[model samples]
Target: MAKWDNMLSMLWMLRSGRKLTAAQIADSLEISVRTVYRYIDALCASGVPVVAESGHDGGIRILESFKETPLFFNSVELKALVDAFKFARGACYPYTEELESALKKVENGLHEEQRHDLSHQTSGMDVISPSRPPSVVPLLRELEQSAKEGRTVRIAYRKANVEQADEREVDPYGLAFDRNEWYAVAFCHQSQTLRTFRVDRISRLEPTEARFEKPERFSTSAYFRNQSEREREADGPLAVIRIEGEPDTLNALCGHWHLRHYLTERTDREARFLIDVPTMNKYLPMYLMTFGTAIRIREPLELKRRIQEMAYGIAKHYENDPD
Candidate 1:
């Protein structure tokens, strides 16, 4: 029997309200008497209230109070546990098999009515991800382990738009997930700098005997956010973009993931953003065009001209076609 199984059997035997000697428990569980003593010590440490007496009446017995105390989770706690697991599973948590086994044990401990209640509570609740996530479970598990153990690993990483994957060794500091992608924040040996890698882009990963000490208090999410801020700053001088529209429309535009960060001011009928020239030329025209006449660009005549060009191109593309 497993260590926990033997210990649980000891607990049940001691719970019988009869004083049982160490020899008796050891004999019943087919373990050494010293092992029984160790199990008793462990149970006591876990607040089981096991009483061990010495002398002619020396034996072990669980406290009567503990024997009567019911071990079960309340309805609210059970529902929370199940719902939390659902969210974790949806996020592609690395320890899914262990999580499933733990949830099964929890459910098995419930009474039939409690089980029915749990099923009913969980039936109406679920975590719906945006799309089916990638199969990076194995990569995640390996990176997580390496990060925790302060180990370095070699990987064949392919950057975006790159054809061939490049081989590099890195000391994985941590991992983060954002925008439906997994990223590893590690110290790249080749670059000799801390960098983030898209986990799915990793074509191959192998453990290395080399080890490294991760910086103290390093946070993957914080690093990623900092990198984004740095990238935005590196985009050169930003142009102040002003727009006027319905209050609701301006609000929605300002709330855009990219624009929100650059937003400098807002009013009932107007919003201002600090946008770079390249971004203004590349993405804003097409995106803002979706708003149609509800909004108007109040500044930066260059952007207005780009929008006009795009609109004219669109009209020209279908000019000779039937409506």
Candidate 2:
């Protein structure tokens, strides 16, 4: 038998709660007495709780408490682990291959009936991503490693609306995923400020010898949230967006990601949000138009006028077209 197999067999023998001598174990396994002692030492190092007492009436035996405890996961635990793996894979987790290998070993330790139960439970449920996820595992792995090691990296990043990628050296603090996109929160040496870069927009990344000390209690999520809040506040002066509509329509409008942050009040037929005037005039008009007659803008006559102008423009454009 292979070394591992022999050691496992010896463990099972000790688990029988019998006080068998080293010579007796070797004789049963067709190995030398010294080999039995070596296997016992290996099992102890692996946390098997094997007890080898010397002298008469003293023999190898597993601890009573250790023998009573279950070594393999139950059905519920197995199902949760497999389902979590599915979600992680859907999110493009960088360590998915290693996670899968670890899960397989866990499953292999289960009984046949437990495995069957897990298969049946997981087959009926799955996570459905809203869109096809981007393939960014390599980028995620590299950034994660650099952040963990406190190392700086140079990246060729293409920002939105820019035609060419620019090279920048940044100290990657951490990575975050929001709204189906991956972002690296880092400190840019060129800009001398902390910034967020879209991982998918990075055209090239290379490690540098530069290193940095991460701040104590630094939280990537909190920093990202604060940045978003500051941006919203910087748009312009706050203005009330009052709308009267069907209950469901109002609910949907109030629940919008951008609008929800500013939602002030809601009723069966009305929803009120406190957002910036520039944002309302520049972006909200077209989106509100989608609701058509189902909703009515109750305040900020400027928004209603903007929506009318957009509708008239659409009407005239289509009227003049031949097709």
- Per-model TM against the reference: 0.57, 0.59
- Which candidate number has the best lDDT? 1
RMSD of each: 12.8, 11.8
- Which residue pairs in candidate 1 collide? none
lDDT of 2 at 308: 88
**TM-score, predicted candidate 1 vs. hidden true structure:** 0.57
Kindly provide the TM-score of model 2 when superposed on the true structure, using C-alpha atoms: 0.59
Candidate 1 per-residue lDDT over residues 201-290, each given as its tens digit: 898899999999998999986776566566553475678899999999998898775667678899999998887787777888999999
Name the best candidate (by TM-score): 2
Model 1 clashes, total count: 0
- Model 2, global lDDT: 0.84
Per-residue lDDT for 1-323 in model 2, tens only? 86667887887788788989999999989999999988887666556788878987898889887844324455677889999999888777789999999899888766567778999988987877655335478889999999999999999999999989999999999998876778999999999999999888998899999999888778888886576567663567888888999999988887675767678898898988888887777779988999999999998888988988999999988997886
